[model samples]
Target chain A: MRRELTISDQRIDEQALGKGRAMSAGMGAAVYFVGVVRATEEGRPIAALEYEAFQPMAEHQFHLLFDQAETRWPLESVRLVHRLGRVAAGETALWMEVVAPHREEAFAACQFIVSEMKRVVPIWKKAFPLA
Target chain B: MPVSVLVLFCSDQAVSGCYKSAVQVRVHFYSYFKDLAGLAEVTESVAPGSRLEDFLQKLFLRFPKLAAMKKSALVAVGIDYQAGDYVLAEGDEVSLFPPVQGG
Candidate 1:
């Protein structure tokens, strides 16, 4: 299966993740990363964070990141789901699943994808400070 | 000047004299800018061959507060980020986003 990348306003589905399990024989590790919306931002208490994305472009950028990761690591599959609209503090803002034959590459590629995703993804965040 | 009216007063010498026609760009704002602009999208006109920066200057003129984000804003036409010097074409769907803080 190919990389599954999505940008949506709904909450992330935790149960329907890591579908690449069937390929586990060839892939030894599945690294999952979850990015949460912090209770405070820049030292200020926050009620929640509002996330928005240029959908088409955000998806495009994530594809590029997937491509980048492929050349750098032998991966079985990649999955990324970023939330939109309002996300409460301590909630999942992002969820990523990276599958590879080795833990090193699985971890490295997972980190690389997130780093590159942050750099180029056309996703924006607005913090709502607690009054 | 209202951004809608400023379209007719383009400063780009490349097409300044030719006021007969102009390129219309559909602009969409995201995130911080979406709220700042108070509207999801708006179509703006600019001189033929006008660069993205030229159009942004006019946009800032209409919304002085947005000017503060001029340096940090990200511009994209279609699905790719575009440089300020990139020339805009007719009917282009332009998107402007403030510095992203996504994870």
Candidate 2:
């Protein structure tokens, strides 16, 4: 499977993420998720978010997630990218894509990856309020 | 009974030269714990035979903010995730991670 862990200080490349997976003749569905930094935090207005991660550990966790996903479904590829440092409101902070032979597996794997990433990965974010 | 004494006791064990086999483990902190500790990493001197719980007790005593996150934090040694009962080795790269909120 084609898996990735990208950490950038700049805005995530939306177009690049859309083209991350190679079109396979056997694959019938491609599901993608992009998580953007929103403007509110618990009803409080926010300017942006600062994200931090233990790089080595985070990468290792991604591999573990990929392994689990592949074991549960027949997948063609998986790509995950996360932004670090300061990300302004409305800016994309994360990207995830999955390709499979059917929409059922593709959608299931996509949801699983996103949910598990939030629950298990070693990345954290703190919101900065609008002044 | 105080946090300070617990911290000093742990340090004295290493400083008094009593535990000649003491080794240093570098702990990298992330997220709110980093902000609270005001450091990205700290060197923890632990006796050679100590377990992960022993080291964490000293660590929590040194940084109470981390102690508060005991239930929510995740830990790893080197590249693999480890349980609190796992024994620590010399020069281990231990890291403490707060509950992830990433998407």
lDDT of 2 by residue, A44-130 (tens): 999999998777777888889999999999999998888999999999899888999999999999999999988878888889999
Please report, as a residue range, the 10-residue window in candidate 1 chain B with the lowest summed lDDT: B4-13
Best by TM-score: 2
The CAPRI class of candidate 1 is medium
> Per-residue lDDT for B1-103 in model 2, tens only?
6564222224444466353456789998877778877799999888777788788889989998788888877888987778888988778988887878886
Local error of candidate 2 at residue A123 (angstroms): 1.0
Off by over 4 Å in 1: A18-20, B1-20
Q: Which ten residues in a row are the worst by lDDT in model 1 chain A?
A: A15-24
lDDT of 1 by residue, B1-103 (tens): 6556334545344775545567789999887787788888988888789898889899888767778888888888999988889999877988888876777
- Clash pairs, candidate 1, are none
Local error of candidate 1 at residue B19 (angstroms): 8.1
